[model samples]
Target chain A: MIDVQLIGLLNATLQAATLLFIAALGELITEKSGILNLGVEGMISVGAVSGFITAINTENLFLAVIVGVLSASAFSSIHAFVTVVLKQDQTVSGLILTILGLSLSSLIGKPYVGKKLEVKLESLIDIEEPLNIFQVLLNQNLIFYIAILLMIFTAYVLKKTMFGRRIEAIGEDLKSADSMGLKIAKTQFIATCVGGAFAGLSGVYLTLSYVPYWTDGMTSGRGWIALALVIFGGWKPYRTAFGALLFGFLEALGPRLQTYGFEMSPYIVKITPYIITILVLVFLTIIKNGNTGAPKNIGIPFFRENR
Target chain B: MNKFILSKKLYRNELATFYSFLIGFLIALAVGSLILFIQEKNPFDVFSLMLKLSIGSVNSLSNSLNKAIPLILAGLGISIINSVKLWNIGAEGQIFMGAIALNFVYINTSINNSQIYIFLLLVSGFLGGAFCILFPAVAKVLFGVNEIITTLLTNYIVFGLTIYLINGAWKDPASLNFPAAAYVSESVYLPTVIGKLSSGFLICILFTLIAYYIKDKSVFGYEMRIAGGSALTAIYAGINAKQKAFFAMLIGGGFAGLAGAIELLSQTHRVSTGISQGFGYTAIIVAAITGMRPVGIFLVGCLFGALTIGGSVIQTIGVSSYIAEIIQATTLFGALIAQFFFSYEILKKSEND
Candidate 1:
C-alpha cells in the first residue's frame, strides 16, 4: 500500500514538474537572450484555448499541438515587435500582453467553456501488469518524455552551440555584441517567439492531458510560478528542471497530505510554494551575494544608434 | 534615394505625453470598434450607448467616480514607487492584505465610536500594505534581489490566505453556504455623499494632492528623483539612495493599503475575495499613461472607470465585458508607440549626406 501511494505521489509530482519545466525553460531561453518577456501567462492562455478548440473540432492531438504552438508564437511576435523593434519598455509591454491574452482567450473561449475533447494523448507505455518502480516512473504521457528531451536539448543549445554563445554575448553586453556583428534585434525577436511557443506547449499539455476539459483561466497562476522557477533555477537549464520538480513535489504534497488525514487548510498548503519561492530566492541571493546569474541587459531594449 | 533616421531630441517635449495619451485613446477606440464590427455589432451605436450608460447622467458619472476612488489611490501608490525606479507589482496582493488587516482589527476590537473605528481601520490598512511590501523592499535594498518577482510571488500567497480565511474562519455564520465575512456595523460605514459616491472619493483626492506636492515641490522628492536616476550620482550628492528607495516602496505600499481600507469601508462593508476587481493592475496603466503625475492619475483613473462601467453596460447587447480589458491593453500599446515617436523624430535625409 505504501509503495503504491509513494509511486502515485511521484507520478503526480512528475506531471506537475513537466508543465513547469517546459514553461520555465522557455522563459529561461528568452531571458538568456536579454529579452524579458513577462507574457508567459498570456501566451499560455492563447495556446490553451486555441489548442483546446482545435482538438475539439478536429479530434487530432498532433494538429492541435501544432496550432497551439503556432498561435502562441504569433501572439508573442507582438511582444517582439513592440519591445524589440519599437524599443519600448519590456515590462509594460509584457504586462499588456498578459492582459490582452487573458481577455482575448476568454472572449474566444466563451463558447467552449466546460467542453471536453474526446481525443486524449496516451501514455508512452501501456503495461497492464503490476509495474515496478522504474516502470511506474517511465509510464507517462508523450509530453512528459518530450519535456525531458526538450530540457536536454535546451541545455545543449545554450551551452555548446555557437548560436548559444552569441545569445549570451548579446544578453551580457549589447554594444559589444553589436560591434561583433551579432544581429541583436533578430536574435532577440526569435528568442522571444521560441519562448512563447514553449509557453503555448505547456498550456496545450494542461488542457489536452492534465485537465482534458476547457475551463476559463485554467492556467491559473502556474505561468507566474514558472516565471519564478526560472529565477529560482539561477537561469540554468538543468537547475530550472530541478527547481520545477521541487515545486511540483510541493504542489502534489498538499492534496496527498489531506488524503492521509492531515488536518491542514488546503489554502495554507497552496501558499507554501509561493512562500518557499521567496525564501529560496532570499537564500540564493544571500549566499551568492548578488550574482543571481541574470542577464545584464535583460530588460533593456537594444538600440544600435545609442550603442 | 532618401532614408529616414531617428534623431534624439535635445530637450524633452512637454506636450508629448498629452499627444501620446490622445493617440493612445483614439487607437484603443479603433481597436474596440474593429472587434465590435467583427462581432457584427454597429460600432458607432455601441460606443454611443457605452458612453451614455457610463457618463451620460450625473448619477452614472458619480458611480464612475466611486469606482475610480480605489484606482486613483492605487495609481498614486504605484507612481510613488516608479519615481524611485522600483516596481511594486504586488499592489493587488497588498490591497488584499490591507483589507484582511483592517477586517481583523475591526473584528478584534470593541470600539464603538464611528470616527475612531474608521481612523483605526485606515491606519491598520496602511500598515498591512506596508508590511506586505516590507520584505521585498528590504530584500531589494540589502541583497539586491529582484523586487518584481518577490513582490509578485507574495500576491499569490496573500490571495491564498484570503481564500482560507473566507472559507474557514471568516465565513459568515448567518449566511448559509456562502464564503464571506459578516458585514461591519452600519455606523462605521463611510457616509455616501451622492448616490453611491462615498467620502472615499474625498480621501483619494486628498492623498493625490498630497502626493503631487511631495513629488514635485519637496526635498525628499528631489532626493528620490536623484537616487532613482543614478545611485552613484546620488551618493556624490550626499544622498542615501537605498534609503530613499526603501521609503518610497513603503509609501507606495501604504497607498495601496489605504485604498483597500477605503474600498472596504465605502463600497463592500464586508470582506470577500471579490473586493478588488483588478484595481491594482489597472492603476499601473493609469500611472504609466500619466507619467506618475497625481492629477493625471486622477483623470486617467476616472476614464478607465468609465470604460469598465461602459463595458458592463454593453453586455446587455450580448457583448463580452472583456472588451474593456482588451481596450485597456491596446491603449497601453498605442501609448508606447506614441511615446517612441515623440522621443525619436524620424528625419528624411540623403543617403550620402
Candidate 2:
C-alpha cells in the first residue's frame, strides 16, 4: 500500500514541476525557432513582479497572469530587437536582460514585501473525501492542469505541424530555410514572444501557487534550471516536462526525507538539483556521438546578408 | 524621399563611438524617466540625488570606487573571455568560490607576514575562481557544451556550498545570529588608500592594465580575436582554438576570483553569500557596452560603479534600486544599437550594382 506521505511527496512534486515545466516548454519553442534565449530568467523576473503587482492591485488571478505574460514578453521583445534585428550577441543580451529583470523585479517587489494574497487561486476541479488515485491525480491547483495541458499541446504542435517543420528547418539551416522562403525573422520573433508569454505564466504560477507571496528574487534560479531542462530534454516538450518532474522530486526531497527520518541539511538538499544538472551535462558530453539534438543555428542570430 | 540602407564602414572613427554613447545615455535617461513616472517619483530629483550620493563628497566617491573594485576586476575577466567569444556567466559563483578560498587559507594556514599572506590569499582567490570554471570550460572545449548553461548552473552549486559552509562548518560562534564565517585575521586586512577605498582598488586598476596589455598587445590576444571572429579561420590559421578557450576561461575566472578576494580582504573582511552583489552580472553588461574594448571597460566600469551606489541612494526615499538596473540595461541596449550602426550604416537608398 502506498503511504500518505508518498502521495504528499508526489503532490508537492507536481506543484514544483508545473512551473518549471511551463518555462522549459516555452524556452524549447524559442530554441526550436533558432534562438538560444539566455534571458528566460529575466523574463520570469519581470513576469513575477508584474504578476504580483497585478494580483495585489486588481485581485484577479487570471488578469494577473495575463499581465505577467505580457510584461515578460515585452522585456523579451527588446532582446529580440537587439539579437534578431541588430545582430548583437545573444548570450550577452540575455545576461543583461536577466540583470535588468531581477533589478526591476526587486524594485517592484520592495513595497509588496510581506504582503499576503487577498484572493487565492481556486482549483478547477473540486473533490472532497475518500480520495482515490484518480481523485488524487485530478485534484490540484488550476495552474497544474494548465501546465500538463500546455505540455501536451506543445509536444503535439512541435511534432505534427507545418509550423514545427518551419522552425526545425530554420534552426538546422537558416540560410537554406530562407532560400526555401521561410520567414526566419518573423517566425523567430513570434516564437520568442510566445516563449516569453509562457515564461510569464511560469512566474505567475510562482506568485499565485508555488510560493504564494511576494518576495524579491523568488524565482531564484528556477529560470536557470528551466533553461537546463530544455537542454536535458533535447528541446522536446514532453521530455522537458519529465526533466522538470525529476528536478521537482529532488526539490521536494527535503520535506519528503524529513518525513522518512533522514533529516538532511536543507541547503545541501537545495543544491542536489544543480549538482545533478552538472553531472548529467558532463556525462552527456563524455558519452560522445549520439546526437546532442541542439538546434544548429540557435545562438547565431539570423541576418539578411547576401553572402 | 530618403530610405535607410545599411552600408558597411571601412574604418570606425572615434566620432561614431562618441555619438553612440551620447545617444545611448540619452535613451537610458528617457527610459529611466518613464519608469520613475510609473512609480510616482520625480525622475529628475531621484537622478540628481543619485548623482549627488555617488560623488557628493570624498567619502562617498571612495565608497563607489571601493564597490567598483569587484566589477572592474570581473569586467576584465568578461572582456578577456569575450575575446575568444566565450560567455563568462559564472563569475558570480567564481567570486563566491574566491571568498571561500581566501577564508579557507586564512582559517587553515597561519601566515604572520601581512604582505606575503595577502599575496597568497590573492593566489588562492584566483585559483578558487579558476577552479569553479575549469570543469565547465573543459566540458565546453571537449564536449561542445554551451558555456552559458554550464557556467550558470555552477553558480547555484557555488552558492549552496557557500551557504552550507557559512551556516554549518565555518559558522562563527561569536556573531550571534548572522550567517558569516569567522573573520579573517586583522593582520590580513589591506590598508585603505582613499577615504574608505582599500588598496584593492589599486590592484583592480593594475589588473585592468595587465588585461589591456594581454588583449591589445599579445600574440595570444591576436589568436583569440581570430577564433572569436571565426573558428574555421582560427583553426586554419593554426591558432590552437582549444588552448585559447581554456586560457580565456582561466584568466577570466581568475580576475573574478581576485575581485572576491578584494572584497573579503578589503571591507567585508568575512566570507558571506552577499559578497558578489551581482557584480558578475553587471560586469557582463559593462563588457557588452564597450564591445569588449579594454579601455572602454575601465570607463564604463566607473560609470556602472556610480550607478551601483545610485541604486542605493533612491532607497533612502523608499525608492527601489531597480531604477539603476533599468538605466544600466537601457544604456547597454542603446550602446549596442549604436555599435551596430557604427559597423553598418543606414545610407540613403540609391540605385547601385
Candidate 2's fnat? 0.76
The CA lDDT at B44 in model 2 is 91
**How far out, in Å, is residue A147 in model 1?**
1.7
Q: Of the candidates shown, which would achieve the greatest lDDT relative to the real structure?
A: 1
Error of 2 at B263 (Å): 0.6
Which candidate should be chosen as best, given DockQ against the real structure?
1
lDDT of 2 by residue, A136-203 (tens): 67778887888888888888877788998888899889999989988888888888888899999999
- List the DockQ of the predictions in order: 0.71, 0.64
